[model samples]
Target chain A: MNNLAVDLPGLQLKNPIMPASGCFGFGREYSEFYDLSKLGAIMMKAATGSERFGNATPRVAETASGMLNAIGLQNPGVESIIETEVSYLANYELPIIANIAGSSIEEYEKVAAAFNETDHVHALELNISCPNVKEGGIQFGTDPKMAANVTERVKKASNLPVYVKLSPNVSDIVAMATAVEAAGADGLSMINTLTGMQIHLPSKRPLLANQTGGLSGAAIKPVAIRMIYEVKQQVSIPIIGMGGITTSEDVLEFLLAGASAVAVGTANFQNPFICPELIDALPHTLKKYGFNTVQDAIGKGITV
Target chain B: MKKETMRIKSTKRIALDTVEMVLENNYMSQTAVPGQFLHLLVSGHTLRRPISIADVNKTEHTITILFKMLGSGTHDLASYQVGMTIDALGPSGNGFQLHNDNQSTILLIGGGIGVPPLYYLGKTLAQLDMHIISVLGFQTSKSVFYEEKFRALGETYIVTDDGSYGDQGFVTDVLHSVESFDRYYSCGPVPMLQAVTASLKDKPGYISLEERMGCGVGACFACVIPTDDAGGYKKICKDGPVFDAQEVSL
Candidate 1:
């Protein structure tokens, strides 16, 4: 058997296939389709400091090879997640990564501390980089200093391994990644959705209610690869590469580009069975590429 | 919902832009309810298009779905013919709540492509020996379909905006002419739903909303609608494509 196991910071995954946060909702939704325990890890949806209703109608619009979303961290609060979502997710014997977002550093600390008390949660993914929200999201991610500050605060508040999910909407993605790593982030999630907008030609107005949304899917795959490649070179911390990964080949590409693990985003919308499909196909794909272990393939495409 | 590989038995253009597809899937035909929709995986399309179950014939083991060629996905769906196998995940969403013993009249109001799901609903209600009155609206006479099928089931009314078919106005216009109904079921664009909800404020009614979705299974919060609930929002894919008209804020 090919070794698909990956030890990402504090947590060890059966394989490197995990669904991106906001794509997988507590793993129960997809559990109806297949066994959730088969997955390497379940990345819970973004849980804010308080319950958020999210953005208005027309939150998503399709673009060529991709889609845009302005969901704005629509989730039950951290307390609710700990009380409800966490207990529900505990039924599955899989590593659960609590993805938390906040409007301020204190909120981030509070959520991280709360999640730290939870037993089922294996790690915390600090979402300092969601572009859809108005108050707290992408602001911290774009700037290295603010990103470092939030990362430092959240890392201090929690005993669990914290992974900073970086934004691709910045001028220097490497700087942001490095900042988070320096701020004591145990790991890094390279490339959140790119900021984009679509206009309705007939109405002469923006398609999304938020006017702007984060672009994700096949269209942004190349961008994700570039960012992961850059960040992996700059920082020693492990990276979870995700953007528009769909096929097993895409997973191999991200792995080669130095993603210790890969998260499937918009592809989940296209196919709900994607995580398992990718997992099943990974062995064959790696064999075809003449690789013996998943670790051997990691950073193989990079010169460093 | 089960993911079934269904073979298309036939495809016919019922209207100018509308096409009726019959698939030989016994599983879906048996499990499908009135308000539930199927998520079809079209070739070359990234996201599956959520198409409502228009009619299901258990004896024939066939499921009929009506789709309008609005975009590339539907345009590609139009090219599919008999013998082609299509991947479909369905019988999803909470369907309309049917009152079996309620002797009061039930109003089924639909607009455009929204009119198809009502046909199956009307059929189900008819089987229960309930009174079903359907008010269907279309943009023009060319867009009108399933009128005969609905008419054969129960008291059916059709209206066209261009006045080429039945009544010369919206479905609500015909609804206004009707004296009363015990309950109302609606599926249409936002404007029509708003008008119908306003007109039937005092009555108990249900409305099925259509939104551009990500995952048709409620994981992605793409197809969420604001509701008069604690969560403040409900997923149109899961919590409902069909919701109590009064419960959801239009």
Candidate 2:
């Protein structure tokens, strides 16, 4: 009886693998590669109060075992997303988590409230940690008070569970986690990409058009595990860990570090079938580690 | 849009720093169309490099890709030998839309590495019995390739930045010399594409674009170009690597 299922605040996942927001893009494109129902949930691309063109061209640059992107939350406003993207995803049997982002608290509330119209969206991943945006993203994420304030407002606006995505750029990951948790965040999704840049030698300038972008890949895994371990001890809410997850072993490491489930990010670009692949491999890996189920493995690696 | 582990049937240098590698994959060779690209995963690299399909041979069960050693990833790809297998996501992107209507005469404008897909396009058009003409531009004679292949199809001209080749100038410089063309297709750097578009503003044309891509799929909006209408943008990976001449702003 190998059980891969894990229950989070608002998500009843069949397995512990889901595609991270921004990387999955509403589940339309990847739906071509594999069945959407095979995964536990789908974390959609960040949606705002209005449409955003995001950053200019040369938006992504490759680094060692990782990549940098300043996509700046490019999305077709929440209204359009609800009218089309969300409704389209409703056809899937799995849970749909809507990731909401904005330039202000009011915009966050508006975008959060907008998801109430869709019956298919089971949760809301509050994206206060998006490193690419200028005004709202990291500004809210880095400051404890601001992170709590946005969490509180969004919690009031939406019926779905709110999961605050923490940024690794902050000095104290636990402080940001506790603040959001106290403000009523149902769970935590850490860590959003670490702010980094790559310099192109020939051009004698930054590689990404936005100059600096969030770095995510194998290079950020250890940091993610450390943060999840630290924050899990300080906060009581479940943690949906992501950052440099590419293999089933990475998923188990995250679970042991106290993540309830895991999200696949940059690895989706490397292999579109990564989610299902991880889902299939997780049970065997868990058993090899002496765990009967995914839930049994959570926090096993953390010390009091 | 199939993912397959394609084996390299042969690998050789075609021009200066460019390498031509033919990969044997039955599904890809049979399904790939002109201007479609292969998002190949090179060992020791994070992101998969998107290389356009240079040509396809259904009978041989192989698809050819020509790439220049641009950086560490491509340089590593150039090192791969025959019989090696590479993971590929392919026939990706919206390829060129071919029509055998009254637009029988076609002009192909290519610059450097962008010349590969045009070769595939020229080959496909030639099979349709369409009259083809190609104007290829390179940095020098050493960088020029496929001149004879294009000439076998129809009238072909080679232009180089340095006066070591056919004509000393840009492709736009020789545009007026070609008698006439009912339609044109181009793939090159932004400046060259812009110049070609401006010179042939009234002509029906399609241009392939290049951008730094994340997931060579529509999932990531990394490779987007602004639409001409100024309303929104289109993804270069999904909406097109190929677009109508007047569709996108350079």
Candidate 3:
């Protein structure tokens, strides 16, 4: 039996491994690497109300065991994504989750409502946590009231289940998680990239064109696990955990820390085959840890 | 487009802070084109370093990469011994388009590390019997490599910032002396590319660009450059590491 299959709200994943949003880019680039069907689910890039050109050049900086990116939610807006990108993804058999972001509550609602017309989109990953964008993004994620307001409005506007991606730059992660859950969030994608910066010695200035970028990679794994562990005990909704997930062992660690499913982010850049490789390795790794199924391992490490 | 573990066949310092590495991989050697690059994984670094393909020998099943030891990632790549294998994904990005008119003259402009890809392009064009003229620039004489090889192909000019070798000044100084060419191709730093594009604005040409990238594939959107078209931008990793000289904003 394939013990890798996982079920989250509005998503029946073949496995617990999927490429995180922003990292996968609408599944077009990675489709050249391997079969998209091999993935558990596809988290499409963040779509706003209109086109976004994002940050200037030198948007990425490499750090130890990780990388920082200030991509600023660059996308072709919701309508174009639905007509071009989403329609292209509809050819695949797996579920597709649209990651929606915007500068204001009205824009978030408009983007969320727009996804309801798409035939293949199964859920919406509310991206109030993108640290790179200056106008919106992390501002909502860091505040509980703003986070819930966006969540409630998006939930009201869209027919699909909403998964609020939480930012780690907050003073209270549990409060942020519970607030969204109370506001009708069906699930949670916890621990978005931590805010970070790198210095270029020769230039004697910040490395990224944007002063700071969101940090993602193996360096943030422990932080993801800690947040998931804390939020799992407080909320009834499922958690889709991600942060520096690279290996099957890392997947199991996220599952053990209370993530119902895992998303591979920065590691996908390191190896394009990471998501499918993790899917193939998950069953064996699960057996090695004595778990018969993915559901059995969720929150196993969290004590009541 | 494919990921494979390519074995290091040889490694040697070709210039100041520059090392030439020849990696053995039948797939890459065959598929790699003139301006495409190899995204190499150096041990202990999360992101891979993208180095341009300097040469390819399909019969030997090897592709040569020339890069400067700029940071820890590239510094680690320079340390690998012969026979050791390193993971690489590539022959990535759009390569330079070759014009096959035998009677036409083509000019090649390259600066610093950017000079590597032009070597492969020059070699390809030389075989087609097209007239090739190369103007290569460096910081000093010590940083220059492939002067003799380029000279073997066609009329080659060398320039340095400090008058250490050949002409003293940028490649633009020599561009005027070359007289005329049907087309031009360039790969270098952005400022150098901008200057080259400006000087050769009347002639049709292609320019390969470089930027800090996350996913060497198009997914990350980390290496995008603005275009004059309605799409507003193009990903340097996917749409091109190479673009029409007149298309991009610079």
Candidate 4:
């Protein structure tokens, strides 16, 4: 009953449980199970200007507690997303955050400028963390300068809130977080998939065609929480946190780490009921901890 | 699995591997056709595992699933009880098409785990009045399966790489003696599939491929197959897990 509303800087959500890009697929298939309108919002898969074939075979390599994926950011292009996925989800009663990544700065700005007025999209998640692709994806996240430049251009070009999604496969995440924030990023979605791998061993070869992939699941929770906590100390903008979050307690950990909102990424692959369970678990857990709202949990245990 | 088309039914555990628990369920003993599959919701696993219909029985739910314990979800699924109930969505997918009424005899070859779909195929061929010859291949005798059941269907042969069970060599070696069949169908590992395609390049055949799929529908394009065209890519789930050998590159 308490206010679940979250101020995502330039955007507002009734709640903070949006689907991470890639896992939810613009929210249609999952809708077959339950009404998607009940959730906060849907983040579209990463898109570029042209259709990409993605990586080679065996994109997913399952590890003991997590999964590694080298999806190569294979998308149907920005125009296609606008026509197919965005058009459909925009009318679903929630803000659609169009996630985009490109090989260049111009490509980022181009997508931002166009989607700024397209459909019901209220925000743009500039993805600079996808490691599987060849172009401007990981390059932007690895360097603070490129990350800031991309953020600045997208921010200037976009009328909608620009949320820069950061990669965890870096030496210092706070550097990337601070650079993007200073470059006018309105919000931050921390921790895209961590680069990892698995092999058949017997085959004397790598498990995935790409050899390595981004790892996401319950195993990465500890690392994700630590990074979110570190970034929370440096950036004032809201931090979107996700890593192996299969239960509500996981959501609380992100909040306590100073995440303004939390996202359910790899867990969706584990179970479709994760979102509803999270929504219900949050209130009960909040009350259990003697808090009335999730905001009460943010930074509660963080030193900063 | 209804009274009209089905008669025999039973659920049995045939093998337990480090990777998965292979559970077999039987359905539609009378009317169950070849190239068809069933759905099984192994409890503890979030969604149902759509396994190829290994074999059939009319009186009970007929199917078999070899589940690999890759993560917590599938790992939990490996522990499904023998009698526990679970949700399912099947007999889905466009299974391999088998028409014995055709003029020429048919050749069915399968390797590794790809033999699941061939089980029903063999049974259906037995029901028809045609010369059905089969080559069931595996890595070794321990993992080798369905040779006896296949023998019950028609002229069956076996080839194992380890030479533990039958002929020492690949299934392609057994395929060498096949004079001619009007059609051929197979499912197996990628290398085995490539070998099949290469060996039968002069002949016509249909193949079923396995890829890491996101949405089992065309929407995600996660299961795309690279084609001869520079700009063309076919979706395995939608375009097919089954495709004309001539159409697929490998």
DockQ each candidate and list the results. Answer: 0.68, 0.88, 0.86, 0.24
RMSD of 1: 1.5
Output the TM-score of candidate 2.
0.99
Better candidate number, 1 or 3, judged by TM-score: 3
**Cα DockQ of the candidate 3 complex:** 0.86
Report the Cα interface RMSD of each model, rounded to 1 decimal.
1.3, 0.8, 1.0, 4.3
TM-score per model (chain B): 0.96, 0.98, 0.98, 0.80
What candidate 4 gets wrong by more than 4 Å, as runs, is B1-51, B56-58, B66-94, B98-105, B124-131, B162-165, B201-204, B212-223, B229-231, B235-239
> Residue B8: error of model 2 in Å?
0.3
Check candidate 3 and list the clashing pairs.
Answer: A217-A244
**Arranged by lDDT, best first:** 2, 3, 1, 4
**lDDT tens per residue, model 2, B1-250:** 9789999999999999999999999999999999999999999888999999999999999999999998999999999999999999998999998897643899999999999999999999988989999999999999999999999989999999997999999999999999888899999999999999999999999999988889998998999899955547999999899999999999
Could you say which candidate leads in DockQ? 2
Error of 4 at B130 (Å): 6.4
Order of candidate numbers by DockQ, starting with the best: 2, 3, 1, 4
lDDT of 1 by residue, A147-262 (tens): 89999888889899999999888878888888888889999987789999999887899989999999999999999999999888888999999988999999999999999999
Candidate 4: deviation at residue A279, Å?
A: 2.6
**Model 1, range B31-141, lDDT digits (tens) per residue?**
989999999988777778899989999999899999999888899999998999999988889999987665668888999999988889888887887788889999999
lDDT of each: 0.89, 0.93, 0.92, 0.74
Residues B1-250, model 3: lDDT tens digits:
7999999999999999999999999899999999999998899999988888999999999999999999999889989999999999998999999977886899999999999999999999999998899999999999999999999989999999999999999998999999689999999988999999998899999999999988999998999998865658989988889999998898
| Residue ranges of candidate 3 with Cα displaced over 4 Å | B229-231
Q: After aligning candidate 3 to the native by TM-score, how far in Å is the CA of B214 from where it should be?
A: 1.1
